[model samples]
Target: MVCINCKLFSQLNKSVDEQKQKIEDMSGLMEEMGKEEFISVFTEELFDALSKMIEEKKLSMENAILLLKRIGYLKTLKRIHYFGFEKISLSERIEKMIINEEEKKEEKNEKLLVGLCECYLLFYSRVPSSEFLSICVPCLLKAALKKEESEKAQKEVEMALLALSNIYMWTNVPKELYLSEIKEVIQYHQEHHNLTHLAYQSVWAFFTDRMFFEKSLEEVGVNELHLVREAVRELEELTKNVIWMREKKDERGKETNEELLLIRWFMTMKIYLRHCQLQNEEFVGLFNSIVQMFRAAKDNFRKISNECMYIFLVAKGNLSIEIEDLLNGGVVDVALEEMQQPTLGYKMMCYNLEIINSISWQLKGKKKDEKEEAKRKATKRKVLEKMEEKGYEDDIFCFNEILDILNEVNFYDEALSLDISDYFVNV
Candidate 1:
């Protein structure tokens, strides 16, 4: 009854529970305080809880992560830059935590490892110092490549890929060394749906960076186009899966998943359009595929409408014939319908109008290029006739309604200065 070992174990359990409770309480406290004030007051307490959790072997990694998540650590890390707290100190603690988990001889500690990596990524997103990148890149790469056949390990790998993607978003690393590692993950885990999705996102992030996009292959010292080709292949496979998922009769909560894939696919297409000049048949085929997806996706319009706006924006000035056909081919109908919905946000409504404006200006330009006045007049008549058929006049009326709403919302300056003319001109 008076055993020292048993007494010590009981005390350790109490302490662990107290730390978890403190993390839970901090969640409510965060809501009351401004971000800077919250970080200043609770940073030490949060740090101590994490440190104790790592030091004591009492709590499982899952339990520790649950506590951290309850405190909204990831969301806080996103806005870390706005605060005056000691970021370096916090980063040092997380690095130590990662290293400690890595050295553990027990089970792989996947939850704790992924949690620490999540913290690293959020911190890196705000600071992006060379010191941070040096520590983070290799650690995430190792975690991403670690092998475990368990379901828990699969979740860990997904988080690792996501963190790597976040880091790659801000920093420029040697692609030759790490791109293949990411590709290997995708190629090996192609059947693991979530893992493959994250891997493709990582690859997309790497190649779509402004530095990579702006530089030539010889200048960058890598065959990025080859990487782009590989990513396209992966994207095609993912799109097929999404289509299959859509075909299931009882599928629910698939909207978010479909949106993610569509956005990523459009992003990949934007990269290809910019770099390859939209000449590749593969890229053209993908473009057509997305157009068809948009046409067929009747119930999911709200989820994909913004992405459709961006695609139209990118297609402007690149393909005149295709642009005219798209404008006349019911895109105008889609945009008009979305704009009239009372639930639609103002920014999205603006984007919809911009798409219409771009298409209209392009069609106007094409009409001007007709040499014969009679032919020009005939083309104008045909375009107007098509617009009337597609309710373009109603869209023009809605443009004025958008202006009135903008004025009512006190965005009068934006409304007054808004230019639908020359909207097709490249910015």
Candidate 2:
């Protein structure tokens, strides 16, 4: 069994390896070999291969479910509208399968994705009608609640919920389909173990799903506000766990799992700050605690520490003085300087520089006071140019919208409001 698992994992590894080569060729062919190109190429291969694997059924349940998630995420990156929800035939099949196998724990997940390729074919063709949006996908939830140890099943349930959320939003399907299922997914995630991140993502899906219940939420007295508060508590607990905190230790003391958890937490916290915009007292307390943790961490969390600080700045809404102090204060600059040193990890150096450059871009000033703004913009342009001359242009945003946001807000309170309000929209 273990050998078979390894072989299956190798299939994914091989696909990734092939994708890397193709990306390299594409990068060489493009005039600009930057982070955006890398992200785009990697994302395409990741999703395409995942779709293929789902068709082949070559991976284990856990791996197959992960691939399904990768598909969801890659579609998200492309800003592709109405992913799985558009596949009414496939949605009905998956739904019926769940209902049919309601009691067969190991059996249903065994071949749950056999027709996934057909679904992808229809999904990519964009011919699937909007009516697919009305399908109720929470049937998987009924299955997941019974098998608590099934991470694979739990993830699939979340994917189902996410698909329904997309369909409801994209096609303007009745809010009832979206709201009832979303609340169930949220409830399931809150009660389930090892499903925190999925729950966090669902919160965003619900809020952005058909503008969520903007008018309905107010009238129905459904308080997503409290859910946001609960999520904050969950994240704080995850971050502070001993396993996760081990990343704060030095090289010899740090473990890979701990480091990985830190990376995950960084992403989770970012998602929270990005979507929830929950302004409750619990959220405020958790946010401050995270900032303090960032201040006290050791060098092992170097790259992740920068990410956390970036999130902190974004969350606090004080990019003006707060970001300025952090970046210029030698914390980020010195760490970045050390990574770039010849004796350090060269690839690591490249990666670190990319992250730091993005942070710097976020921190760049964009005052409307012409003389001062011009001076700041020129300085920023010079800095970016210098970095680009050194062969790094991955953090380049086509527009200055990010800088504009930082300039507009000066504290976490303001930043949180910005996210929830749809003011300063990404689109």
The numbered model that scores best in lDDT is 1
Candidate 2 residue-wise lDDT, 202-254, digit = tens? 44444454443254543222255354355446555655654434454443332
- Report the Cα lDDT for residue 189, model 1: 56
lDDT of 2: 0.42
Off by over 4 Å in 2: 1-129, 136-174, 188-225, 240-279, 296-298, 316-427
Q: How many clashing pairs in candidate 1? A: 0
Q: Can you write out model 1's per-residue Cα lDDT over 152-202, one digit (the tens) per residue? A: 676566566555555533356655546566556655555444454654565
TM-score of 1: 0.57
lDDT of 1: 0.52
After best superposition, candidate 2 residue 241: deviation in angstroms?
4.8
Candidate 1, residue 369: CA error in Å? 12
- Candidate number of the best TM-score: 1
Off by over 4 Å in 1: 1-48, 52-89, 96-118, 145-153, 186-196, 210-333, 336-345, 363-386, 397-427
How many clashes does the backbone of model 2 have?
A: 7
